[model samples]
Target: MCALKTLSLFLVLALFISPKIQTTTFQTIKPKLSILVDNSKSISYFKEEKNLQDFIYELKNNTRVSDKFEIENYIFSSDLQVSDSIDFLGSATNIYKAVTAVNKLNSEKKAPILLLTDGNQTIGNAYEFMSSEQKVYPIIFGDTTTYTDLKITQINTNKYSYLNNKFPVEVLLNYDGIGAVKKTFSIESGGKTIFSKRMQFSKKEGSRIITFDLVASKVGVNYFTGSIEKIKNEKNIKNNTRNFSVEVIDEQARVLLLTDVLHPDIGSLKKAIESNPQRAVTVSKVADFNGNFSEFELVILYQPTNVFKAVFAKIKKAQCNLFIVTGTNTDWALLNAQQLGFNKNFLQETENYGARYHSSFSTFLQKDIGFEQFPPLKDAFGILNFYREHQDIVLQEIRGVETTQPLISFLEQEKQKIAVVFGEGIWRWRAASFLRSGTFQDFDQFIGNAVQYVTAHKNKARLEVNSEHIYASNTVINIAAFFTDTNYKFDNSAALEITLTNKETKKKTTFPFSLRNNSYQIALENLSPGVYNFKVQVLGQSHSKYGSFKITKYQMEAQFTHAAAFKLKQLAVNTGGASFYSDEITRLTQDLLTDETYYSEQKAIVKEQILLEWKWLLLLIISACTAEWFLRKYYGKI
Candidate 1:
C-alpha cells in the first residue's frame, strides 16, 4: 500500500518537473579555408624554392590553423586545377582564374582564401575584380628588383599584300634603362636582311616608333622577323625578337561593268572597287564588249536592253556574280522569260522612292551613310515578285510612307550570288555623303562591303567546318561545324570527328565533337605554340574538310620582371584582408588564428520534453489515481 502510494505521488510530480529539466548541446562549425598557389613559369625565378615549399607544408599541417578550418588547395595559371604537386611549368599566369575557381568551389559555404603568387598576372582579367564576399590574404613571392629590358613592343602591318607592292611596316621599340645606347633595328625576310637602321635611345624609359617600307617580292606566305640587337644585362631577351607572316597573293579579281550608256554611276563604282589593291574594274558597253565572259569573276549590269540578251545567257553559263541595276530601260519581258529568279509588273509610270535602312539585313554590315539625306532614286512604278524564299533585304522603299518593298536585296540561287537594286541614281548617294560628312568613306565602305560579300567564294558542301586561322597560345581553340542534308537543312544525326596534328612535332590527337543546338563544336585547350593541321570527317559519309592554323607563343610571363605588390595590397585592402611577403608567410597563420571573424562558430541546441507531449506520464498519473480510487472504493474508504 505504501509503495503504491509512493508511485502514484511520483507520477504526478514527474509531469510538471520534466518540463523544467532540459538538455543543451553545442555544435562547433569550422570555418572553411581555401588556398590558391601560383604555378606559372615566373615562380621559378625565386631564389629559395625550399622556403616556398616549407611555408606551404607548415600552413597545411599546422593544427592550430588547420583545426579551425576545412582547408582546400588549388593551383592556377591560365586555368585552375586541384592538385598538390607544384611543377612551376605553366607558361602563363592568370590571378583572376584562381579566385574564380575558389569562388565556384565554395559558393555555398563562403570562406577566407590564402593566395600565394608573384602577383604578375599575364593573361586574363585583373584579380582586383575578384568577388568581394570572400576575404583574400595575398602572400607575394618573386624578386622585387628593377632590371633593364629592351624589347620590340608591337609590329603593325597588314596580314596580306599585293605582289610587287610596297607595304608599310611599323615597329614599336621600348627601352628601360638609365643611360643612352645605340641599337640596330633590322628586318629579315627570305633569309636576308632586307632593311636595317641604327637608332639611339636617349630617354630613361620610353619607346621609339620606326617605320619601314618593304616590297612584297614573293608570292607565298612570307615570314618576316623584326629584331633589335640585345643590350647587356637585359632582363628578358625572348621578347627582343618578333615574327610576323604576310601572305602575298598574285591573283587579282577582274570585274567587268556592262552599261547601256555612259553614267557617273559607272565611274563611282569603278573607283570604289579599285580602292582595294586586289581588285581591277573595267567598264565597257554591252555592244562593245569583245573579251571572253569567263575572264571576269564579277559582272555589273546597268539597265540591260534586248540587244544583249545573249550576253546575259553567257554570264549565266559562266556562273559569275551579278549586281543588276534596274531602271526604266530594263527589258522586263525578256528578263522575266529567262526565269532570273524575279518578275516585275510595270504600271507604265515612274516613281521617286527614298531609301529606308532595313534592320534585319545581315548579309553584310551596313554603314551609317545617312541614307535619309541622300536624294531619292527613280524606279518604275511596279510590284516585284521574288521567287526565292530567303531574300536578304538591304533597303526598303519610302515613297511617301515606309513600305516593305525591297529597294536593294540579295539572292543566292544555284550556287550564284545575285544582288538587285530596284532603282537607279546611286551616284547621288556618294556626292551627298561627301557633302554631309566631308568624306566619302561611308559611301565607299557601303559599296565595298557589298562587292566583297558577293565576290567571296561560297561553300556548297553539305558539311562545313569553321575556325580562325590564327590563335594565341593561351586561348582555347574553338572549332565549330555545320552539317546539312542534300536539301540544305541542318542535320545533327551524324557523328563528327576531328584529327589534329602538330606540324612541328607531328603528333596526332583525335577528338569527337559534341552536338549543341543543331551544330557540332569542339574546344581544344593546352595546345603548344605551333602550327596545327586539322581534318574533320563526318561518319557514314565521305565528306571531309582540311585546314591549318597557327598558335603564337605566349610570352606574357616574360613581360614583367618584378612582382606587383601594389596590386596585391590593393586587393587585400578591398577584400578586408592583409597582405604579406613570402618571408612573412608565417605571420599569416597567426593573423588568421587571431582574427575574430575567422574563428569557429558554436550553435546551442536545447531539447525540452513538454508536459503536453508526455502522453505516457499522463496515462501513468491517470492509472495511479484510478487505482487509488478503486482501492479506496473497494475498501469502503471513499
Candidate 2:
C-alpha cells in the first residue's frame, strides 16, 4: 500500500512540472525593412548627408522597437554610393538605386524605408525607381517656392548719428520679379518713419538695384528697419525686410588732442578723428588741459614733454582710455613716476632712406580717426623704431625697408589700463603720402579703431551677440546675450525683449523678461530644425542695444549610440512615430496585429518564472532540519 502511494505521488508531480516546462519557452522577432530615396539633384544651400542620416535613424529605430519587422534601407541616385541594402552600412540615394537595394533584401521579412528628400531629382531613372515601390512616403522641407527672392545686397551709413542732420545712407537691392509692378519701401528709424520711396523693378532679365538716403535726429547710434511691399508670390518674406544702424551725432565726439609740437602725425590723426564734422572733437594743446580736459572720450597725446605730466596724471585718474604717442620729448620722468615706461631699446637711429614711388595707401590710414586727406609723409629721416610687439595697434602703415612695429601698447600696471604709442614721425606720412595712395580719405581710420578698442570698457551700456547654435526638429536652443550698463544695475527692474524670426516661414516670436548681473536667458523650445535668426533688444536708463542670435539644425548622431537604446526607439516610432522620405516602417509592424506572429515575436518576455527560487530555499531549510533530527536520533544527542 505504501509503494502504490509513492508511485501515484510521483505521477502527479511529473504532470505539474511538465506544464511549467512547456510554458517557459523564449522567442525573438527581427523585423526587416527597406529604405527608398531620390537624390538626383544636389541642393546648393544644404547638405544631402543630413537627410540620409535622419532617414536611416528613423528606419532602424522603428524596426528595432517593432517585433514584426527588420529593416533593409536603400537609396537611388545618379552617383551610387549604396545600392538596395538590408545592411545598416552603405549609401545610395537615387530611386532606381533604392529599388535595386530593395530587391536584395530578404523576402520572408517585411520591407519599409522612411524615405526623405527635398524633391529635387535631376539625374537617374526616376520613373523606374518610383514605379518599383508604390509604398514610398516622403517628408520634405525645402524647395516649395520657385520665385526669385529680393534681398538687401548692402547697406552703408554712419554707425552713429549727429543730432538733427541728414546721414548719408546707401542701400542695394536685388531681385527677379515681374517688371510690371512698382514696389514702395519704407524705413523705420528710432521709433519713427524717416524715409519712404517708390521704386520699379528692372524690366530686363536680371536683378533690380535700389539705393537711397536717410536723416537722423538723435545723438546716439540708431538702428533702422526697412521693408518693401510684398509681392503675390514672394519666395521668402524674411528677404523683404532689412536692418541697418546709423550714429547721429548732435555734438561731435570731443577729442582732447594734447601735443607739445605741431607734429604731422598729430595732424594726420586729428584729420582722421574729425573726418565726421558731426563729432565735435576739440583739438587742444597740452597747455590748456588743466581747465578743459574733462570733455573728451579720448585723450590723444603726441610727443608730450615732462611739462604735461600734470595733465596726463589727471587723465589717468579720471579712468579714461588714452592713446599716447612717444617721441624724443616724451616725459620720461613723469612716465616712470606714473609707471608708463617703454623698453630702453625702443628708439634706434637709421640712415635716411627713400621708399620707391609706389603711391600706395596704408591700411592704418583708412581707419576712422577722421583724416580727410592722409598724404604720405615724403622722404624724411630720424626714424624711431618700436621694440615691443603690440597687437592692439589698429593698423600698420604700408612699409618699405623699415621693419614696422607697434608704436602703441596697453599697460596694466598698478591696476590701471593705459595705451602708449612709443614714438612720433608718424606725421611725415600724412603731409606727404596722401598724393600716392588714392585711399586716403579726409580722416585717419586707424585712430578710430584705436579709440574704439581702448574705450571698449568705458561705454557704460553696451550690447553684443554671443553665439549662433543649431539643433534638429523639436529641439531647445539656448541663445546667450551680454548686457552691461555702468549707470544702471542689472536687476529685476531691467527689461529686455527677445524676438525670434524664421526666415523661411516668416514667423516671429517675441519674449520679454528682466535681467541680473547684466545677463539674461531666453529658452527656445519645440522649434523645427533649420537656420533661425534672433534679435535681442535691451532697454536701460543709459542706452538701448540690439543683438542677433542664430540657430542651426543638429545633423550628426555621434552622441546617439547603442547605449541610448531608449532614445533610439523614440527617434523612429513610438507605437506609431513620424518618419521622413520613402521609408515604410508601417508594413514591418503589420504582422504585429496577427495572433500567430504576435505570439511568435516574443522579445519583451521575462525568462524567470519567479525570481529567487524560494521553494529551493525552503528545501534547503528542510534538509538542514532533517540532518539535525537524524543526528539526534542516530547519535543520541544530549
Candidate 3:
C-alpha cells in the first residue's frame, strides 16, 4: 500500500515541477580557401596547361593543408564557373571578373584566394588596381622576362561612313627594344598599301600614335589592315597586324523643304526630318528651286503661295509624297483650287488654336506628348474639310472648347500620300517638348514617325528584320523580326527562319528564330570574322528580307606573347598577399599549412527543453504507478 501510494505521488509531483534540460556541444569551423584556375586560351599560348594542372592536383591532395582549411575549386576565363575545365580554349581572360566573383560568395568566414593565370586580361578593368578585403595569392604562368617586340596595341575608328566622305583612323604602336630603331607602319586595303609612314622609337620613347583619314569611295564594307614592321627574331608576330572594318552606306533618303517664305517653322521641320540618320533634309525657296525631283522621297510645302504652283504641278505628275503646312500667310483660295487632298474655308482673320490629340487616330503610333499643354498654333479662323477619307491625328480647340475641326490629317489616294497641318508655329511645340522632357527626342520622334509614314513605300514588307550592320567578334549578335497581317496587325502563328551566308567562304548556315516578347529572335553566340549576308523569311509566306553584317577580326587572347608578371605582382601587393611562379606550388602549400591567422574555430551550441515532455520518462512513471496499484489491489482483504 505504501509503495503504490508513493509511486503515484512522485509522478504527480514530477509533472507539476516540469524540469528543463541544458545540452552543450562544440562545432569545428574551418577557414575557407578559394582556388581559381585559368581556363582561357592564353594559357595554351603560353604552354602552361601542364603546370596549372599539376599545381591544382598537389594543392588539393596536400593532407596538412586540407586538414587546416576548407578548400573550394573554381575555374575562370571570361567568367567564373564552379568546376575545372583544363581545355584552355576560352576566348578571353578576365582576372578581375574572377576575383570579383570570389568576393561575392556568401560566407561569414573570409577566405584567402589562389589565382592561376598568365596575368593577361583580355577584357574587364585592370585587376591590380582593384581593392579587396581578402588576400589574393597569384600564381603566374609562362615566361616572365621582357623581350624585344614591336606590336600594334590599339586602334580607333568609326564603324560607319557615308559615300565619298573621309573617316579617321588612329593606331597605337609600341616597341620594347633597348636600342633606338626605325620601322615602317602601314595600312592596307584590298591587298594594296593605302598609307605608310616610317616611325622611329627609342628606349625613352617607345610608343607612337598615328592618326589619319581615309576616303570612303566604295559603297559597302571597307576593311583595312594595320601593321607594324617586325624586328628581327621577334618572339611572336601575331600582334604585329590588326584589322578593322567600316560599313559605307549610300542609301540615305533625301527630303526637300520647299517654302515660299523663310520662317522658324521651316527650320524646325528640317531639323526634325534630319534627326533620323536614314533621311537627309535640304532647305530651298520654292521659286528658286531647280533640282531633280526623282532624288527626293518627301517634299515639305511650307506656307505655299502662288509661286509654288509649278512645284505642285511637278509633285502631282511625279506622284511624290507631300507635307503641307498652312497659316495666316497661306493663300486659301489658291490652295483649295489646286485640289491637294483638302479644302479650307476662311477669311483674312487669324486665330490661335490649341492642339487636342485624337484617341481613335491610327494613321501612325502617336505619342501623347501633353498636347493639351502645348502653346496654341496660329492660323486663319477656318475649318478644314477633307475631300477624301483620312485619319485625323490632332483636333483644334478654341477658347477651351474642343471643336470637330481637324488640325493634323493624312490622306492617301492613287499611290500618293499627303499630310496637312492646318496651323503653323510647330517650332513652339518643339521648344515645349524640350522644356518638359529635357530632350527633343519626344517631339522629334513624333515628327519623324509621321514623315516616315508619308514617305513609306507602296509595297510594305510583311516581315521586318532589325539588326545592326556591324559587330565585334567578342560580342553576342542577335537578330529580331516582326511579322504582321494584311491589316498591319502582328501575326504570331507563322514560323520565321533565317539563313546566314559568309561572303568570303561561300558557307551558309540556317537558324530559326523563336517567338519571344512578341517578336521572333535568334542569338548567334559565336561567329567567325568576316562579312555575312542573311535572308529572313516566313516559312509559309513568299516574302523575304535581306541584310548584311560584318564582324571585326579581334583576338585579344592571341595579342600578347608573354605573361604580365608586373600586374600580378602589383595585385598581390595591393591585397597584402604573395606572388608565386608555377614551380612554387610546394612553397604555397607549406605557407598555407603554417599560417596561424587562418585557423580552425570552435563554436559551442547549447539547447534546452522541458524534461516533463519526454516520452520515455513519462512511460516509466506510468508503468511504476500501475504495478504498485495492481499489487495493492491484489493484497486487499475487502
Top lDDT hit: 3
Candidate 2 total steric clashes: 79
TM-score winner, 1 or 2: 1
Q: Per-residue error at 9 for model 1, in Å?
A: 30
lDDT (Cα, tens digit) per residue for candidate 2, span 1-638: 33434544554454455433223555676544444544432332334455456545664566334445554444555433355432222112344444445545544444434445444432234322233222333444333434545555545665555666666777776666555566777788656777788776754733544566566665554556677787677644555666655555555566677777775676667776666564445566767655545566667777667777687668767765577776666654455455453443322332222222221221111223322233222221233333332333322243444334333455433333456655556665454445433234422454554555454443334554444332333334555455544432224345677777776787988887445333565666666643456667776454444443333222221111112222223333432333332233355334333424223356555454443354654555455556656756677663
Task: Report lDDT per candidate.
Answer: 0.79, 0.49, 0.84
For model 3, what is the C-alpha lDDT against the true structure? 0.84
What TM-score does structure 1 among the candidates reach?
0.56
After superposition on all CA atoms, how large is the RMSD of candidate 1? 13.4
Model 1 CA lDDT for position 612: 44
lDDT: worst 10-residue window of model 3 = 359-368
Model 3 earns a TM-score of 0.61
TM-scores of the models, in the order given: 0.56, 0.38, 0.61
Clashes (N, CA, C under 3 Å) per candidate: 0, 79, 0
Q: Which segments of model 1 are wrong by more than 4 Å?
A: 1-27, 45-51, 81-87, 100-110, 128-133, 156-170, 211-221, 247-459, 467-481, 489-535, 550-555, 558-560, 602-638
lDDT of 1 by residue, 523-630 (tens): 988888888889999987999999888787745566666788888998899888889998885688889888887767889999874644578887877787778878
- Score residue 500 of candidate 2 by CA lDDT: 73
User: What residue pairs are clashing in model 3?
Assistant: none
Supply candidate 3's per-residue lDDT for 496: 90
Which residue pairs collide in model 1, if any?
Answer: none
